[model samples]
Target: MDDDTILVTGATGGLGREVLARARRTGRPVRALTRRAALPDDPGVAWFTGDLTTGASLDAAFAGAGTVIHCASDTRHPKHDIPGFHHLLAAAERGGTRHIVNISIVGVDRIPYGYYRVKLEGERLLAASGTGWTNLRATQFPELLDKAFTVLSRLPVMLVPAGALCQPVDRGEVADRLVELALEAPAGRVPDLAGPVVQRLDRMAAGWLRAAGKRRPVLAVPLPGKLGAGLRAGALTSPARAVGRRTWEQYLAGKASR
Candidate 1:
């Protein structure tokens, strides 16, 4: 890892932060690109302020980087994704980057959500970039599930989508995998990474509440559209490949221990 200078975009995000930390532990030169000027000071990381929508700022970010981890994504404002992704790919090409590693969500193809659609489009663009690339599709993170529980606990009765299945994974594990991918040659579209157990959203929520020492009624409401149907059919879960070892329950336990 010390042989190459790796650049990590979205360095402040949950997954990106872990990647940045892991990269630093490798003793390699790590560069981080963010939209903000001020970031936590780290001697191992060189911070560069840049917006993915504008290609001008990325010139300095990509300079002398052999590998680029494209974890930067727009979930809320998806309008900027296509242009931003295109610009990044072009920059990587021009910079002579050896590989591009992307973190994507599992079941993106089955879900019709706008964000997932944008992610699929990004994947397509990267595939056509002619540069070596690897796309990793992972399940929802445990932290997201924990956040959902916090919101649902506020209600007297939590309303959850019936038949919705999820295999939430650990963000740390996913970050480790991303770093490993960044170091290796691009193996286009690697195997999906997911949690060990397939659980209903309601059940997971209930367990989270119980673990947090809260009690709330769980109402399972069936969703009425294609999006709901996709979730209920377990399209978002990877049954053939249960890769991650940490379960939601184990994650909760670890949190409690901490």
Candidate 2:
């Protein structure tokens, strides 16, 4: 019930795990909220079973927490995005939570993607919620960019979106920024974080192949609709805010070594 207690949702996810690790380093009370009961035996972290979409066990998860790091999201099941966040906001308000830090993606407003639309609404709901809040939108992660190529590497040729550009940031560093926000005063929608470099998707995918000890030809395919045009025009990137340290090639090289 202390003001120092920090509750983190989606604690098992990529960025959420990093946040928990960093939060543990602070020596403050930390609560990790996840849908599963099975969690590692980390003495420094207290695990709470909960589901953001179903709003189950959130009362106990949010109880006595001053700050709630709302990282739980459903991009694949886009339908759950809005309702899940709504449930979080409601729980935070009722539980008397002080601050809520939300993780969002860049170009949600500009991009016509369905998941992005849901995320945008989540941001809106959080802003209007009766609790303190901070929303941080970041560029795509290096692993996400790697996935497209990983699957395409199976074929003789890698197909990429025509003229699309990506500034893939590192999730580790992003977790750093999120924890920083959680510690500081609630700032609504801070400056976005992007990758150190901006390059075409085809080039990034090709680098993945080289790092994986494979060879494949990259072909750029033109995509239709506003989604394609926005990507081609760099709508998904924050060029001026390219503050991330890791690059796609560096991530790939490190992966290859592992």
Candidate 3:
């Protein structure tokens, strides 16, 4: 219950795990919030069982936490994301949490994707929550793209969105930034973090196929309506804010080595 305690939700996720690792290195009291009842044996980290969607066990999770890195999200069931975030905000408010560092996707407003819309709403809710908050919008992660390609590869060919440009930023780099922002005073909507290069989805899929040693043909199929137009217009990219150092190729190389 230390005032300097930093709580990280969704500690088991790809981005959340990275954030938790970096936060632990700060030598401050770090609490990890997970929905699972079983806790890990990491002595340095205080693990709490909590579900953000239903606000279960959040009081203990947020107790005495001065800063919260709001990394917990339900991308699979985005409908639960908003309600979960609402619960998080309420818990933070009750705990007098000074800062809530939220991780959001780039082009949430520009993109017409359902998940992006959910993310945008989360930002709005945090801003209106009247608590100290910081939101960092970052581009897609290489892992996400890799997963998408992996699934598509099962169909004999990769059916990537035609003319869709993707900026795959490293999740670890994003985690570093989130931890940095969590330690500092609340700054509303900080500058975006994007990958070093912007490339079309087809090219990115090709790179994935090469890295994964797959022999699937890449097919660029244009999506109809606003989604296609939004992507073709490069709504997912942040050319001016390509602050991320790691590129898709580097990530692929590293993944191949592992």
Candidate 4:
């Protein structure tokens, strides 16, 4: 366990927390950045208070960090994405950081969604930054799918958009891969990591209902757009390279046990 510290942005979020926890298991010092000082105190971990919006704040957070795991993203509110990511990359370059590990979604370039477009732009910036970097593109998290279902299940019958393919991964597994990337030398763009099985969006919604002890009938409604067509045509799932360990059922079981 050397004093060489790895900096993790978005430390309070689900994937970020898992990355920090796994990084700490190696006994290496971790500097985790958050928007506020709400993280639990840990001796092995130092907290840096900063947001991605401000380049100065990000520069302060990157100080003394050898490697950076950039898990911070603004998918919910994409308006801040371009500027935030630009500032983050600039700050990392200024701080003389060696390795940068970035987490991205699979099919970001293929999908016509606004968030994915922003993510693709961010990836482009990192790729051309002249720094040692590895970008990990992964599928959606099972937790995220479950949360989406929970929100949609409020209706009398859940209406799933037809022609959407999904291969949701476990956040823990994605976290492990991101930490591994942070520790090792840069490998450029890595292969996409997906779940064990490719499922349709309607089926995934049904699975969620079953896992949560609910019985909401799922109806598939055809969508009329390129984004819907891409999703339905299995653009989001990778069949030959499904490399995840935890299945959706296993994730649900773990949640039930907890």
Candidate 5:
């Protein structure tokens, strides 16, 4: 219940784990919230069991934590995101949490995808919640693309969206910015963070195939609607704000080395 504790939601996930590790380096009391009833002990973090979807055990999670870095999202069931976010906002308000830094995807407003729509609504809710908040919109993460490619590579040929452009930022880089924002006063809707390069999806897929030692041919398939058009238009990229230092090639190289 330290007043200076920084609570991280989704602490076991990719980005959240990075944020939690970096936040611990600052020597402040760090709390990690997870849905799991039991977690392996981590001496630096005070673990809290909570569920945003049901608003279960949230009061104890938010109890005296001055800042919250919200990185939780259920991509499979995107419909639950809004309700979960609403629960978070309510808990923050009730607990008098001083600042909240929310992680969101880029092009959420322009993209027609259901998950992106939910993310956009979450941003709006945080802004109107009467609590101090900051929202960061980042482009696609390399891990997400890697998972997609793993699924698509199972077919005879990889089917990539025709002319689809993607900017795959490293999750760790995004985590760095989120933790930096969490320590500062809330700055609403800060500048977008993007990958170092914007490359065609097919090219990225080819790179993945090479790295993973898969010899599948890549075929660019035309997407027939607004969803396809949005990706082709590069709505998911922020060329001007391409401040992320790590490249997809670097991420793949590191993964291969590991």
Candidate 6:
């Protein structure tokens, strides 16, 4: 393990950046896969330029890398998630990759959201990748909640799914767990990671409004069909498996201070 280089995809994204930073502190050789041709001046960081969509130029990225932390996803083009991930799997196999750590969202199996469907397919692909792998399902992040509220705030009144429960974990905490998985022997599927507290969607929205200094009133509307029912039933949260330490209110306070 000491000689193997840890390669991370989606190096520019929020979670991936946290993974890269934590990996660097461990003093293990780290390589960040990106689309840009130019890399930074940091001697410790090795940058690989490649396109996962076509799998072209990935040879250089997979070369000499024994462990891979896959944090990249194609949300805009859901169709691309599986094909691109297949490209990664093929390259990893050819490169003699020992372990692959994948990040996934909780409730992908039950949620009917388009992007979640793609994530579910990804899980299938990894299970049969024929390589050592570990997949982790983490609850929603504070950033995602913040973004959702920001978009809904466009309306005069923010409409939330009534009785919907949420467990929002910090991105940095999830990153730490991914790195821990990458360091250990491959685990097929780990336990779910969740936030410290399970709160109602309306409560989270109120906290966000207070932090952002907005007075927009939040209205809870009963969501329809299975998706709404699952959320209202607390399908996204694991009260017994609250592995993360940071709470949503703490996250809001942290953002406000910054």
TM-score of 3: 0.98
Report the CA-based lDDT of candidate 3 relative to the real structure. 0.92
lDDT agreement of model 1 with the native: 0.88
Instruction: Output the lDDT of residue 15, model 6.
Output: 91
Supply the global lDDT for candidate 5. 0.92
**Which residue pairs does candidate 5 place in steric collision?**
none
Per-residue lDDT, model 2, residue 48, is: 89
RMSD (Cα, Å) for all candidates, in order, is: 1.9, 1.0, 1.0, 1.9, 1.0, 1.4
Provide the lowest-lDDT 10-residue window in model 2: 144-153
For model 1, residues 1-258, the per-residue Cα lDDT tens digits are 222999999899888899999988877789998888787687778999888887658878887788999888776798788899988988887777878999999999999899999999999999999988999999999998788778877989988999999998889999999999998999999999998889999998888877888878899999989999999999889987788988899998977777
lDDT agreement with native, every candidate = 0.88, 0.89, 0.92, 0.85, 0.92, 0.89
Candidate 6 residues lying further than 4 Å off, grouped into runs, are 1-3
Model 4 clash tally, residue pairs: 2
Q: Which stretches in model 4 have alpha-carbon errors above 4 Å? A: 1-3
Number of clashes recorded per candidate: 0, 0, 0, 2, 0, 0
Q: Is candidate 3 or candidate 6 better by lDDT?
A: 3
Winner by TM-score between candidate 6 and candidate 5: 5
Q: Which regions of candidate 5 deviate over 4 angstroms?
A: none
> What does the lDDT read for residue 46 in candidate 1?
94
TM-score of each model, paired residue for residue? 0.95, 0.97, 0.98, 0.94, 0.98, 0.96
Model 3 regions lying over 4 Å from their true place? none
Candidate 5 residue-wise lDDT, 183-252, digit = tens: 8999999999999999999999999999998999999999989989999999999999999999999999
User: Which of 4 and 6 is the better model by lDDT?
Assistant: 6
Tens digit of per-residue lDDT, candidate 6, span 1-258:
333789999887789889999888877889998866776676778888887888888987787689999998766787877888999999888777889999998899987888988898889999998989999999999999999999988888989999999999999999999999999999999999999999999989988988988889999999999999999988889888898999898999988887
